[model samples]
Target: MAGIDLSLKEMMAIDGALGAAVVDYSSGMALGTLGGSKELDLAVASAGNTEVVRGKMRTIEQLNLKEGIDDILITLTRQYHIIMPLTGRKGGGLFLYLALDRERANLALARHRLKAVEEAIAV
Candidate 1:
C-alpha cells in the first residue's frame, strides 16, 4: 500500500489538480493538505466538504439505498471539486478531496486517478 504522503503527492500530479487534501469526515478536520492558492484555503474547504459528505451519506440512509458513493462531484462555472471517500484497508471515515480547473481537467481521468489513489492510500 502507498503511504499517505506519497499518495497525496501522486494526487497532486494529476492534470488540472489545483489542490488536494486528506480529510476526516467524522470531525471535519484536514489531516494533510497540498497545493492551494492564497484565494483558496484547503483546510476550510475540507471542513465544509465534510458536511457535503455527511449530508449525502445521510440521504442515502434515509432513502434506504444499499449503494455506496464512489465520489461526489460538484461542478461550478470555473472549477470542479471531487470528493472521494477512502475504501481501502486503512481508509475508513476519511476521504480524498481534490480541486480541479474545469477548463484543464478531464473529469473521467480525474475520477479514475482518484480511484487509483484511494486504492493505494494507506491511512
Candidate 2:
C-alpha cells in the first residue's frame, strides 16, 4: 500500500489534475492535499464537499435503498470534481476529492486512477 503522501502525488500525476485532497467527511478536514491553484481553496472545498457527501448518505438511508455510494461526481463549466468515499473498515467516512480541468482530463481514466489511489492509500 502507498503512504498518504505518495498516493496524493500519484493522483496529481493524472493528466489535467488540478488538485487532490484526502479528506475526512465526518470532520470536514483535509488530511493531505496537492496541486491546488489560487482559485481552488482545497480546505474550503473539502469542507463543503463533506456536507455534500453526508447529505447524500443521509438521503440514501432515508430512501432505504440498501446501497452504498461509490463516488459523487460534480461537473462544472470548467472543471470536474470527483468525490470518492473510502470503503474498508479503516477508511470509512473518509474520501478522496479530486479536481480536474475538464478540457484536459479524461474522466474515465481519472475515475480509474482515483479508485487505485483509494485502494493504495493507507489511512
Candidate 3:
C-alpha cells in the first residue's frame, strides 16, 4: 500500500490536477497535501470541504438513507472539486480531496484514478 506522500503524488499525476490533500474531516485539517498554488490553498480548502462532508453526512443520516456517499462533486466555472471520504479501517475520519482544471480534466477518469489512489493509501 502507498503512504500519504506517494498517494498524493499519484493523485497529482492525474490529468488537470491542480491540488490534492488527505484531510481529517473530524478536525477539519489536512494531514497531507500537494500541488496547491496561492489561490488554491490546499489547507484552507481541506478545512472548508470538511464542512461539506459533514453536512452531507448529516443530511444522509437525517434522511435515513442506507447508502453511503461515493463522492461529492463541486463543479465551478473553471474547476472541479472532488471530495471522497475514505471508508477503509485505516482511513476512517479522513477524506481525499482533488481539484482539477475544468478544461483539462476528464471527470470520469479522474474519479476512477482517485478511487485507485484511495485504495492504495495506507494511512
Candidate 4:
C-alpha cells in the first residue's frame, strides 16, 4: 500500500492529469493535493466535490440501496473529473479526486488506472 504522497504522485503520473487530491468528504477538506494549475484549484475543487459525494450518498440512502458508490465521473467540455470514495475501513469518508485534460486523456484508461491507484492507497 502507498501513503498519501505516493498515491497522489502516482495519480499525477496518469496521462492528462491536471490535478489530484485526497479529500475528506465528511468535512470537505483536502488531506493532500498535487498538480493543480492556477485555473484548477485542488482544494476548492475538493470541497465542491464533497457536496457531490454527500448528495449521491443521501440519494442512495433514501432509495435504500445496499450497494455503495464506486466512483463518480463528471465530463466537461475541456476536462474530465473523477471522484472515487475509499471503501476500506481506514479510508471511510475519504475520497480521491482527479482532473484530466479531455483532449489528452483516454477516459477508459484513466478510470482503470485511477481504480488501481485507489486500491493501493494506505490511508
Best by lDDT: 3
Order of candidate numbers by lDDT, starting with the best: 3, 4, 2, 1
lDDT of 2 by residue, 31-66 (tens): 999989799999999999999999999999999998
Q: How many clashes in each candidate?
A: 0, 0, 0, 0
Pairs of residues at least 3 apart in sequence or in different chains that clash in candidate 4: none
Q: TM-score of the candidate numbered 4?
A: 0.98
Q: Which clashing pairs does model 2 show?
A: none
lDDT score of model 1?
0.92
lDDT of 3 at 15: 100
Pairs clashing within candidate 3: none
Model 2 alpha-carbon drift over 4 Å, by segment: none
Q: For each candidate in the order shown, give its overall lDDT on alpha carbons.
A: 0.92, 0.93, 0.96, 0.94
Better of 1 and 2 by lDDT: 2
Question: Mind giving the per-residue lDDT tens digits that candidate 4 earns over 26-105?
Answer: 89999999999899989899999999999999999999999888899999999999999998776779999999999999
